[model samples]
Target: MKKFIYFIFGGVTFILGTIGIFLPILPTVPFYLASGFFWVRSSDQAYQFLLSNKWYQQYVTEWLVKRKMTVRQRIQILLILFVLLAIPFIAVPNTWMRLVLGCVFIGHCIFFIFFFDKKRTRQKISSENKIFFR
Candidate 1:
């Protein structure tokens, strides 16, 4: 029963994450992460499929392993965030809401600029070090 529930949730979140690829306002990573979480708990096959997927490899696994994004990736994410938020920032009539949107934009900018792209030293994997797929 628990595994069944997890599988169902994983499927739902995976669909959302896939949809998010085409919809800028809907975030891709979070949904993918959620799907991965459920899949890992429920079905190893599903989790492995996600791990081997090109999109997941490019977007989620790279970030998870490296803890940083390339400049181009960072720029793309920022631009999407800007475009998604800019419309509301401009069209919203409520002053407080506009202020909130502006703040959110600024916050996203700061995070992607300073924090998301931080450089880290890569440790050399020696022959003795085994890389686990899971």
Candidate 2:
């Protein structure tokens, strides 16, 4: 049962991470993190493969191991979210609520970009199991 959950998580993460490589709108690290988290639980082979992969490991593992994000990565994340946040505001038909949402998104994005550290603070807390076992 636990392995099942890990497999699902890894599969989903790998899929989304793959998509994210091509689509800037999607985040690569989060999905890779999901994949790594699951892969670590289910299969050592899978986990090793993921960590050594061409692109997945670079950003994801840094957070996994050192809990740090390279400066370039955070800039990219900020830019991506900034652009994505603008999309709904441009498309939505509702005025008042849309305005509210726009304001909220703007504020949230601002706060997130200002406060979150792509290397350490932005990432989820490390799982002890991943550290000790994987």
Candidate 3:
């Protein structure tokens, strides 16, 4: 039952992420990452499928293996997230609401800056669980 729920949740999130690729307001990578998380917990087959997929790999599996995004990818994702988060901050008429949004924005900024380390070198992803440098 838990596995079934996870599979369903993962499918839904992955669909949302795919739709997000076409819609500016929707976030793409995050949803797929969430889907990958649920799928990984639900089934090894699903996890392996996602890991083998070239396009989907970037969303989560690559991060799992590498432990961090490449510097360029991190900068791009952060800048986009900041801009999207700023929309509410700029458009909201209420001062207190804007302040709250400001805090949320700051929190995300801090998270991306500190939570993820920079990828210094390109590592060869191995067939095994371990990662190695070329």
Candidate 4:
């Protein structure tokens, strides 16, 4: 029963993550991470599939493994967040809400820039297997 619940939750999270890929308002990475976590607990097959997914391997696996992201990846994420956050920052009429959004945006920028390690050249990801190693 517990495994069944985890499987259901994992499937829902994975679906939401997939939808998030196209919807800027929805965060893609967190949902995927949560889905992977639940799947690992409930079903190894689901976990393996997610870990092996090309998109996941390209965009998330490196950060998961080494807490690193390429310079390009970092910039891309920042740009996406900027564009997405702009909606609430500009469209929302409430000054306090906009200010809150701005703070969150600033916080995200600071954390991403200051905390994550820069991806090194030696961490070349193999195209076929998507494996990265020093």
- TM-score of each model, in listed order: 0.78, 0.59, 0.62, 0.71
Task: Judging by lDDT, tell me the better candidate of 1 and 4.
Answer: 1
Pick the winner on TM-score between candidates 1 and 2. 1
- Candidate 2 global lDDT: 0.74
Model 2 scores worst on lDDT over the 10 consecutive residues at: 117-126
Model 4 agreement with the true structure over 1-134: per-residue lDDT tens digits: 99889889999988888888788677778898889889999989989999998767755776766566777877887888888888878888999998888898899888886567344323443432464332
Candidate number of the best lDDT:
1
Which pairs of residues have clashing backbones in candidate 1?
Answer: none
Candidate 4: 10-residue stretch with minimal lDDT: 120-129
Q: lDDT of model 3 at residue 26?
A: 83
Question: Can you give the lDDT of residue 72 in candidate 4?
Answer: 85
Compared with the true structure, model 1 gives a TM-score of 0.78
Candidate 2 residue-wise lDDT, 37-103, digit = tens: 8999998988898978978756565554555555676666666776776677678777986778678
Candidate 3 residue-wise lDDT, 95-121, digit = tens: 998888778878877876655644323
Report the Cα lDDT for residue 116, model 4: 76
- Report the lDDT of model 2 for residue 114: 48
Q: Model 3, poorest ten-residue lDDT window?
A: 120-129
Give the top-scoring candidate (TM-score).
1
Ranking by TM-score: 1, 4, 3, 2
